[model samples]
Target: MSTTAHSLDRLIDESVFAGRIYLDGEWIEGGGGEIASIEPATGETLAMVGVASAADVARAAEGAARAQREWAATPHPVRAGVLRRAGQLWEQHAEEIMGWNVREVGAIPPLAGFALHVTAAECYEASALPSAPLGQVLSSEEPRISLAEQVPVGVVGVISPFNVPLILGIRAVAPALALGNAVLLKPDPRTVITGGVSMVRIFEEAGLPAGLLQLVPGGAEVGEAMVSDPRVRVIAFTGSTRAGRAVGELAGRHLKRAHLELGGNSAFLVRADADVDQAVNLATWGAFLHQGQICMTVGRHIVHESLFDAYVEKLAAKAESMVVGDPAAGQVHLGPLIDEVQRDRVHTLVQDAVAQGAELRAGGTYEGLFYRPTVLANTPRDAAAYCDEVFGPVASVVSYSTDDEAVELASATDYGLSLGIVSKDALGALDLARRIPTGIVHINDQTVNDEANAPFGGTGSSGTGSRHGGVQANVDAFTETRWITLRREPGQYPL
Candidate 1:
């Protein structure tokens, strides 16, 4: 093992660091070769992870198909037990997991800890699903007992992204498994260790049966294979809107269901009645958290014209005050972007917006992969940063004169995953929130937030209407419904 792997040996097993793919109850080399997981903050190679080819994905899917029957047949309590144990394991290894998250995803300690906490909470919440009501009795027109029941969707394919890998990946995995479905997980190669390898280890240690969850780390090809695989009945995807469209289209072609949780350019509104300082604090946290990599991060800051200038100035000052560095090396408020590709994309958006007449109130530069938190004022609606999802630490501020205008500006984008409205008048803010079409809304809070039991998803380009979380949503996403009827005697059929 290399020096980096040696350093991680205590946190992660050496066997995992040996760079193997977990499939079909075995750890083996991937047919697609390997990818090196790099630390964005330092540009250091943390681990060499095996990459799964399309063929490997097919094999994993087939194995999952075979294993699902038995897993579904297993006692519900027993399955729930495994998920409970996984939740405990997440908490037990919180420090270690946080360490991996910091190195793999350029996450600050608090963000990494948040991922850990949410992941554990997800597992714990999923544990309750097994015993939840799965079926309901219905009165039949004829003399027969009718029932509508939920059943596992067989093998489920989960494709997760690099940002907030643990939480995004586990939210689907835990619920699907607790519902007695097999899973084939495809994590981004950049975050293979934290997202893929850590998951496999956790389940294995928790006594989950083999072949139930396969970890395949690769890029688009592997994801495509999983989505197209006949054995895979459902696809749970979390990623860019561009990739989600392809996944949804391919799943449709195959006549399968896909739960797509795609990208978002959420809006954060500050009304004239709101406290300017408080609004600035919320906006900074919403826009700069995890370097603004979250899909729910506030991409558009819509402030009332009366408080717009003050909000911009305060936000810019907050951005400048934040420290950016390698989270693993020292204390810093923010970390680097996941890689140079992401850094460049973020910078390009900021530059494009400035060229289009958006005033650069603060930031718009980088030292290495660490992008300075950016604040833009007078951003044109057509500016790339304002119109698109920058997925970086960028706060694009725009002013609105009235509540109606604020709603119009906030709802302008094709994406509508989350919305935040700040106002002392709770009823008025709620009224404004009701007008916007979004999956989640924060009355006093910022856009970036999540709970394991909440129904999470969005409308429009953000995602399919299918949500993830809560007993009902989880059942709907990972299972299928069947109607059964029983007759006391032989019933005459209508001719």
Candidate 2:
């Protein structure tokens, strides 16, 4: 198959663009390393993803360091133009990108389209140079002067995950390149063919210089190398908390900068007076969108006792009607889990919860990688599924007689990424929103995640550092804040 996906009749050509690894401005094998990626839907061997050794990561980092200075010296306006052009190229290739996202990453077409939209906007903003913050040149009482400036860090190593690959990867790469920093991106092996390679082409299409962006598509060893590389000044990662801790440890040891967007068990609360219909519809997005692989997907739910049974019945019924099948079909509401491992994990969670006495009001079984859009109610607080992230289409719900209980129930989890509330009283909703311990709170809707421009990240187990709103995870990851002074006279004042 051609790199361009639409030219082929089917979504996945299976003959080309499969198992290909693009590194350091070239597509090559992992030397002695190789791994296969099978279509979870049919168990067909689609392609092989190169498994890079730690040495390959070191080479990529060296390349990034070598080209970083030149890239940092490129004029800012020209850099901005390149990014804008990249956004245009991204639009041109949306079809191929979306197809890869659907077939390889197992994202439904609608969600893939949304991911592409976010990618275009993010790349444009990341590449488009921001107005330098102006400094006030006020004449000081001590008769002093002032100055203004901005500078670039060296090389950044970006490690992204399977869910929302394009957005998360470029979320670091775009800003790093635009800010005159070179980038070495290690895209998750699952969707690197489209998420990683296509991103490189977009940058090249927009006139980015060679070596400005280097990609290393692999698994664990590469991740370790990227985070621990002495030349890689910054590391941006999105994955699990266990992995985030490992990254944090390595960063601490090496004095490297690491930005982590870890796991989340976001909660959605429905009050007694909430619009039941709206809450049920919101369930579709909050719990099952992208099959709940999102870091901020609503995995834990709290419903007022007044509406608990009614809401559970409605939500479970809606989920039961959902179509869990081929992502390319365009008629399905939900798709299969990424692979067998994730499928088994989801199944284990649901089964364990049922065994522990939680009421499984809906699906609790799996057919290969397909875990039906499932829901659970009467989840006892002690049940493992009650407060943990299932990371699948499974939703665990508990009842709360008071709003205070809702807040307590929501905050009980170690994560604090996001929380959604449904209340008839506006003030009550706002009050709960303020009290809820989460980075994002939605009052009337269940989908708490909003615009790409918004500041998004989590608290506690979720993560440290923000992903959007101009606070790049890279530069902000490891930085030293300083207070500089400009003196009018040659003599300096004492502290």
lDDT by residue (294-399, candidate 2, tens digit) is 8878888788888888889998998888888888765688778888888888888888888888888888877878788889888777776777878898888888
**Top of the candidates by lDDT:** 1
User: Pairing residues by index, what is the TM-score of model 2?
Assistant: 0.91
| Residue 305 Cα positional deviation in candidate 1, in Å, after optimal superposition | 0.9
lDDT of each: 0.91, 0.76
Candidate 2 vs. truth: CA RMSD?
A: 3.4
Tens digits of per-residue lDDT, candidate 1, 7-56, equal 32354675544567988767788998887888888888887898989989
* Residue 422, model 1: Cα distance from true site in angstroms: 0.5
What's the TM-score of every candidate structure? 0.97, 0.91
Model 2 score (lDDT): 0.76
Candidate number of the best TM-score = 1
Pairs that collide, model 2: 1-16, 19-48
Worst 10 residues of 1 by lDDT: 2-11
